[model samples]
Target: MHRTRRLVPAIAAMVAGAVLAAGTVSACQADQKPEPEQSAAAPVVPAAPTPTPLPSAAPGTAGPDAERSAWLGEQLREIVDAQHFDDVVNAKTGKRPPAMPNVDVAVIELDDTGRPVAAANTLLTQKHPHGVAVPVTRDLSAPGVRWTHWSNSVWAAKKSTEPLLADRGDAPLEFMTPYPASVFKLIVAFGVARLADRGGVRYDEVYDYRPRKATCPDGRKPGKHSVSWWLDAMLTYSSNTATCALLMMLHERDGVAPMNGALRSLGLPTLRVVNTDPADGGGWSFWGLTMTALDTSRLLLLFTEAPGTLWRTPKGDPVTVGVLKRSSRATLRKMLRDQGLNQALSTANWCGQDYPAQGIPHAVPKRWIDPATGVVHVEDRTYRGDVRKCADDAEVEFAHKTGLVPSAGADAGIVTALPGAKPRRYVISVFSNLGCTYVDFVGAYDGACRYTEKLATLGAAVDALMTKTAGRATATLVSGG
Candidate 1:
């Protein structure tokens, strides 16, 4: 079932890229039915720039005149190499993260013009290289980076298999990997805000969100919510119901075509959103979303980077049109900061909880529907509890989104080196599909869970790397480790 559904999006992505390159997207012609309009209170504001064709370099290399980028990449390479991720085991669970995990990582500094370039490096895994350094703004392409048909550069490998070009040497890696859930919320959030920036949608307008697929927390029906309310609910709480409503709204406003256009206009061709509606018998809800670590890092920069550094056109011309407005960026940042699902990447920021020998039994509550009555019931149960790893003292604020399903775990965000700390910032995006198919929250949250622990370790390492580079002697990185 999953494989079949996955194929649909892959096919759609191929077609969408083709249509986009021709300067006419047939998908945008999504039955122009009468749709609700934005409230009159907010005015249209065209903001920043258009997405442009980026230059490409080989994995683990930088563009012209980018020595700093090379150094940063080297720093990131050392951090990942030190972990020995593949063999690492959680002491509590006594389980490895993934016998074979599909993973991709991108780390790029955001201090400069926000052009992602770092040292070229790769990690050797028992199965394959843990990652090929396709620095966000460098490499990952041939003949240069083009948004159209970007998938041609992807390095798709079966578990424990090497890339076909591994022996030949020069292979441009594609960071745009498919994610089942969670991480794509960033794209959804970006879509809503981008539409608002273009004046086609307003955050203040109210929309009705009916609960259908997932059961409500207390059997409460979700009624009408403002666009902003729904955005907050979808982003902060990871609410599928709210996300459905926003997707419906985007579909009604001429489908995913507009959002794709906005993405391309912003210099991200690898990032695309397909409207997969279960009501249309699509089988899955958010599984149609796809993107790369590099693209995600670039997208996050739009929220925090100076306007001049955001984006440019294919012709190298300044793009003042179709950019995210300042107001929208602030709102999105606030939503990210308020994210409730902080268990993954932010795990390093949490203080550890000591558990007794009994292993801290925990009562887990869940709401489910009976097949016979279509009614929701809450089941309270207890299970072996997990202990938190000791938090790090790396003083940084991570405003980001996390995506997790049994098959995958990911976190992407902007890491700010606390206020009054010389103003250092960077972006880190990670997606690891460890194939941990836990059926329930308790199983997924088990203290020794591989994905969770992996995320925490990666976050901590990156945090440490950032701290070490800051020369702690002069900068006051607040103690939050």
Candidate 2:
């Protein structure tokens, strides 16, 4: 992956402005659970006066920044293969990789923000074994620049923290995607929240949201949901209905960036809704993208901040603690809180591939089941084929998302400690697409599993690879493009 991002200086500038969002959060304020803790992520790492520059920008067209980022990505690739983590599992059959693949597994380490931290050394992390992944033909346009991800700024998140924006570098890497509409959707949701803040409306008092529908005769007298709850459904739950509903609520509030309030307050250079589909695809996504692990990694880093960015007043001043009660970012983040946590996006029915009734041709191989009912709280069912059972025996806890289009497939998420992982924490994201027909269940799974499986194996490799690359540019990044 080769691309450039001017993160250091931008991140460095927001220090003094790092105020919390005001008192705009409506419900579940007290119920907010801390983000799942792994060895504290890179977010905790204070932004330096300037960020270190990335090496690569895009392939065949990098300047200094691009070269560095490319160098970094290449280095990590080498490390993944240094001990042959690539072969830790078969790229093709999902079988174990060759003994050679097992030879040089790369090291994955976490930055202060608990993000994957690796050495900026090496070309591609070399796999101890040969590259056996067969190339598949697929379509998708050439990589184009686009916003791939954005995070809502909340209260108490330090201003010195990184900016709430990131994107795939202009450089083209294999399978990198620009910011998808999901990023914008969330951004719009935040916009609506800001509008509410300005208008003095509260989420709990407006639209309501729930995973299970409320009972009502003819659905006439059922209890209602709040707008914030709907916003949560749009985000954490990725609910299509909630997303569309929330957009409608903010039609009068949003501006050029999608949702509402002054665009300058949110500080988002890119965060606009282009589609409102149940699948979160369509509209702006058609532009093209080239996303990378690093790009997504950056987004993960940004989301860990506080939620007060939505409390800003008309003057862009802080309205609450831990966030600026008066800024656009505060209002934006608080808007999400209006819906509170545990909405449809974060809470949904968990049906594994065995559900059988949906004929959905989907199977969940991973899940974070509820402790009370032992039911899956987060079911990862993107995998097609017979692999539906993958999650049944998993020792590690996994939170995953999978996507597929005719010639395209993708999966990304985090894999935390299972019973067997020595260190017990990993974050992985992968995407793949080809110019061919994905005829049935197998294709659907192919579209998704490849990304997930690669991420699963690769994330583990990152753990080991970075451990070996310390202070050494010659260290590996898992090899094989």
Candidate 3:
């Protein structure tokens, strides 16, 4: 749901030319009472400065790797130049020149053997009007990069809960929105999995959603449902209510004390849940959770390298930890791959899974149901569709998660080429607040769509760099095929 907050005066000036979209609340929070309206709009500040191009290889200098690196650098520069946020600003506000915000990019490439062969880290910068090139800061919390919330993946990986299948019986796993915990449901599902692991619950356990006495702070009654339904809704459809139910069940079974202990044992003591769904709370949205890009990248790496160590302790001891069982990891990866929303990372055209498929699989059909009366109001079962495509036509595979808030956008995951070729994989994480503007409604400016296109373009550029360099190098390094 849309919660209004005062905008920064400076951001207002920067985006004076932007056309604000009509304000709309989240459909997921329809059950909860509307929050008090906010009076002021917050300034939508840009994060980071324009990226500085990677240095080119001196003419006729060095070896083949150097030449490939130089060529890749040039390709990257072209990609960065194409994303000049100034162009967006200039188009919106013709009077004043736009300032260039930085784009934070991290690319790690693995060899045919799955070992890191090369890594590139750089910040692109644009020449200022005064002819000076300033570097953009890598602040994770900056308005430009703050929209990313990769912690959901970690929560899903570490959450332990009881299977709820027994209690659910033959009940259908379905419900109406806005379901709670859309993205946050991963945490709740983990809790349920843990419960099931300990013999405390079953996957069939059913929960009623009819309004009744409950623990929720919003005084809202639970929907007619069960744990299994909620878990599926949370991951596949991002149901808000289902997420709340899972969190509440986990806490009631045994406070977060057990969950926190599990985190400590996994070397993630800081990743803890502190609040219920923001849709049910009175505060800034997403303030209930905290995370950083670096931590997120490390978590994804752990998931990818499960049953293996991502790092070692300062004492030289290997910290081999697998957050989820191999089966669970596979399940989560499948869920991520089957994500209903494909705007950001999927736009890269590299998510080789069945992306061209139309409509979300588990999404609740559009209909009106009164929780109070248990009566049907309206029924629209037609599936909504997503038609965005990658700029390039090449098929690439990626298992990734994307995060979006009012002022930020982010994506992270593992990418690999099609089979047959030496299996090379890369872990790419991108966080950006460059063109994110505070709009009143969920469908605000077209800028977010443009930003997604930019991300897809960058993904393509990175794919080219890895394929051209490593593909050629490995071909030459290997013996006769």
Candidate 4:
């Protein structure tokens, strides 16, 4: 079914206002509480006792529940078949906007230890989706594995007549498409965290804001800040300047090599962090980084059990490693938990109208002063998008990242069903070339709002499936003697 979600203010307008109000803000910032300054990193905690090696269960006998896997697979298929990609037809243009023709989706159930549970009797090999399947592997032996591919011709039927900004012949395998700022921020966070864990960087260490070529999307340079401060800004506010500074730091310190190497060590080679500075032979303004939905999803699964979690090595052997120190992991999670932006996946309707707030810690009061006019607007959750508070409904927490550029929009995160509800945890990652930068209901049709609604629908459906099958046992096969 085509679900409709309330439309929030256009991001382009927000960017314009931010430029007038404060020149350093990016287009993706939303009204939320100010994050406290982190002059010092959180104290690191000692490693916990090593966990026992979890035996890989025979398909469907143990590990992640097979039923859940089957349910998720069906949901993905339905979404692809429903053709939500081109549901919105532009009234004036009389053409459907471009979207990610190849909509890739993956949902993996995680055990308490955070390793992917093997789903029994699940379809490991996907059939030809959208008439052609992109060249990618579905590693059943890898932690949390299930892959599905599909494309809607309607979305891919037409491309924007807009001239290409930069066309390097043929995108690389990891360069599915230049992901948006939000997704890039997530990758930068992982790289920085990995560096800190290896003692190559420190969270509290201050650095001068320097960039080879990258800066805020608005062309302003960011001020100097600590590694932890930049991380908080990048993840929480989607600050392009902060993202650029961190990326520059990574490049100067040769941090990208280690981050990509670490991902390969975990058996993910298609995911990579690139240098966006064009002067350095990278397109800092255009296509900076490349990532896949499945790889992105798997990376998020790691966060579910970071700081001493057992995972698979590149050789498929079991290994327990602390990807992030307990303090580091906790600090990052808190920043995401209090994320000011919730208009994308977190706006999905989990509980009904009674509890409007779909995500965690009821929507707080939102107040913003118009920098252009000096008029202060004070309303209860007024400017903070359409999501409202629901104290009674099941509280779900979405600690994830979202991306929005003129040509593409993406959202990926770990969805957790909090207390007072059946404990269900899963990771979902979605990416598309959909144009979600249009102003809502003005010169253009509400395609961006509709696209967000479609994502919310998927989020709601995933929550339902996970909740319904929570605690259900994996289907087991018995031999007839």
Candidate 5:
């Protein structure tokens, strides 16, 4: 979704007011009693006795999952090679297939030591993501076993990269943008998760935040709510206020440099830490956190992985803050199912419902369950463009976030294909603009959903690819261990 810096006072004011209203903060009551600042980094526990590596599952049934996993590495390339995935844009449609236009894919395979093993790339119409390349003679077999750094790489995405930024500390990956929460959220989430371990805070307890009233920059009442409230807000709602509050907490703990440091740890070589808060950081400036499709998948995987790395300060001191280890991982996943982020959906207000809050009846065949209340819904609202956006509805359930800006309209998120059958999940991120209007391109108002549907199509294709891969792996007969 296009993260427009523009503020809609009506929505902002409502949220600020709701924070102090107490009753509306039903999720959890904030501790009105303030406490002294807690500054100590959570004490790190010594690694538990590294149990002698558990004997690899006796290679018996189904060709070892490892072989299958390994085979997939090659198979993926084969799939890319085998397909007539015309790297050409559809002249009639101007649509780029296989990889998006001006996109880059950075795959980092880790070794047994949690260090980088293999870093390969399949660039689209370029040398590196942003015209920067540093070739290294990397070993695939000796990939870093410590997945921590690898996980962090994906979490940071294309923004701030340092360690792996330049080939020889020179030609670095130049990101002329800020880190998007899509990437930073995972980094920060990792930090929080590790902190939870030290503070003995439960994942469920994290949601126990109350949006206590505070001074907001726009001079709204109670200004804003507590940072804890923002945890859920950012994770579920992607609230800017929550992101800033969390950033404030991080800055207090590690200073401003840590944010940049985390970016460097990953090979972004470009992520920047804004010196000032967006509210106070001058009107409408960018923080530069945009990332690619692959990076997005990586964050999802790391947060889902057990024992992932969280963050390390620029001083090389590690502060256990990755929340991936907590019960909340599952908590957050369930929250996703409950439509946690669906709060905005209820409001029927993206780009102020510029176009198709709901979708064209025949256009969008999807489902929506109220995150606040488990209610199925259909969005049929339209704004800015007076034209009817959604004409009809199909039986399929589709719940996703939509983005629109000048010539760049996108929609990304999970789709529950075959709603009854496990909601056979798929992720889609589409971007396109054909005959797009300026307003549609600026704040991402291209209501056509042309690119959004592309994402939907890509997701469906990937799911099929993975499933087919799995089926072949499972079907292969094995005779010996």
Candidate 6:
């Protein structure tokens, strides 16, 4: 079931007053912070007002549930206040805060049966000093793997059956960005999977990454690889070129309209798939291709829950609800489990890991083809180092996806708490558009690292809260005036 809560005007006013007062204090003390001043990039463009109506349950449930919701709302307000303080400090010091100055978080705790025990959406509505309001930004690059509209679109198009390929008739797919491997690979994988299901293309079928007639600004070609290899590279390593190749193949086969139609069918008409990837060179804003944390959490629930239960088609038709087929879900889950970038949510701290030695592979082998010479070059791409570990050894299995670009960092997934008698599983999605730029610092990117640490701490706190409150009749925390 879907529900939303709108802060009553008086509560909103009080919260805003407290946040702004804190913001003022931070602004005055900005001179104390250190910095290698970077020009302020454009602030996040605020998301359009959420269309989901306020919760109707609030009026009737005046005792425990109401108190719990109010407590959660207060916590959210405090978080927003902290963010505002960071923003003010960053504005004064001209240094990017290691912690995101602005962020949007959604946390949901689900029972064994997949019913939500508690859920919260905290969207920061403060404006930057430059006057731009931070939108509920979701330029969650790697995290996109979890709920890419295209994946659902492909499933809808094929209707859980074989995919039929329509003729492209000579339309050339232009490269939108210099880097399209990750997203392009997704496009291609879905297309190929569709074709494979229909007997048109085999997963092992090797496709030439020849940009022969395609409009490629960088004039890059894909290395010779099978469809399956491309899919693995895209999902595992997040290869941009691999994503591009897949997008081109999809354009050649069925075109973009089907994907858009699929999004609408899945009850997410606003989630757009305009370009292949960010590197597509389209003057498109990354936030334009975004989703709210609430929507994202719901999508994750659909993925983790039983099939044919939670979602419906746009026409109110009962479509098979699970986002992925059982086998496909297993494959996706395996990939997510094996994902090495655990810096965001499943950090060494939250889900304990061996630091630089165990987290991300030092160097991942990558191959790129030059379009001009038709030559393939193999190279090793080194990843960033692990920053910090959790203070306590927490044995939590988080099957998650992390997305990070210069402007944003996001981590979303299913959290399975294994330490207790009754293991708890829930979904947590955190998206941050902090003021910190991604510098090439291993653990020294203090601002970014701090932000991540805060996020992990928040996750841990929420997990603990849920664990303590589980099976309790009422929330234990008393509401303060």
- Which of the numbered candidates is closest to the native, going by highest TM-score? 4
- What is the C-alpha lDDT profile of model 3 across 1-481, one tens digit per residue? 1123223211112223333221222331222223212212102222223333333223332111333333333444454454433333322222222233334455544445343333333333232211111111111111121122222212123221222112323332211000011223334445566566576665577755443333343455467566666666555444445556666566566734675555445443323455443333222233343333333444455445423233433233334324445554565556555544444544422122232111111111112223443232322111122212221332455655554542334556667665544344766655543323322223323322223234554555555555555543331211110
TM-score of candidate 5 relative to the true fold: 0.45
Model 3 reaches what TM-score against the true structure? 0.53
If ranked by TM-score, best first, what sequence of candidates would result? 4, 1, 6, 3, 5, 2
Error of 2 at 393 (Å): 9.7
**Any residue pairs clashing in model 4, and if so which?**
59-120, 60-120, 64-117, 116-144, 276-284, 357-388, 357-389
Clashes of each: 13, 141, 65, 7, 61, 26
Give each model a TM-score. 0.63, 0.41, 0.53, 0.66, 0.45, 0.56
Q: Model 6, which residues run further than 4 Å from truth? A: 1-101, 115-117, 127-204, 212-221, 277-288, 305-308, 318-320, 349-394, 419-422, 435-443, 446-452, 471-481
Expressed as tens digits, the lDDT of each residue in 1-481 for candidate 6 is 1112222211100111101111211222111012111111101111122122222123222111333344444444444343232322232233333332334566655545544444555544222221121212111111111222211112213222111112322322210011111122232333345445555555588866654432332235547788676666556555545555655655555644565555556655434445433232122233224444545565555445432224345355443324445555555555555444455544442122222112211111112323343232322322233222232344456666565543345666677655554455566766654212322122223333222334444454455544554554222222111
Candidate 6 local distance difference test against the native: 0.38
Which has the higher TM-score value, candidate number 4 or candidate number 6? 4
Top lDDT prediction, candidate number: 4
TM-score-superior candidate, 3 or 4: 4
Better of 2 and 3 by TM-score: 3
Model 5 clash tally? 61
Query: lDDT by residue for model 4 over 41-126, one digit each (tens)?
Result: 10011112222233334542323334344444554555443434444333223233343233455566554444454221111111
Predicted candidate 5 versus true structure: per-residue lDDT over 1-481, tens digit per residue = 1122223311110000000110111221111111111112100111112112212213232112343233333433332232212222322232332221232223333222222212223322212222222232211111121011111222223223233222433333332221122324444544454455455344443322222333212222222443345565555444444544555555445534544554455433333434443322111112233344333333433333222232233344332214245464654444333332221112222212422223211122123433443333433322232112331222223333333222223333333333333222323333222112111122232323222222222233333443332212222222221
Relative to the unseen true structure, what is the C-alpha lDDT of residue 444 in candidate 2, on a scale of 0 to 100? 21
lDDT of each: 0.46, 0.29, 0.38, 0.46, 0.30, 0.38
Candidates arranged by lDDT, highest first: 4, 1, 6, 3, 5, 2
> In candidate 2, what are the lDDT values of residues 153-241, reduced to their tens digit?
21112122222234435523212122232333444544554555566456566653222221110111222577656655555434545
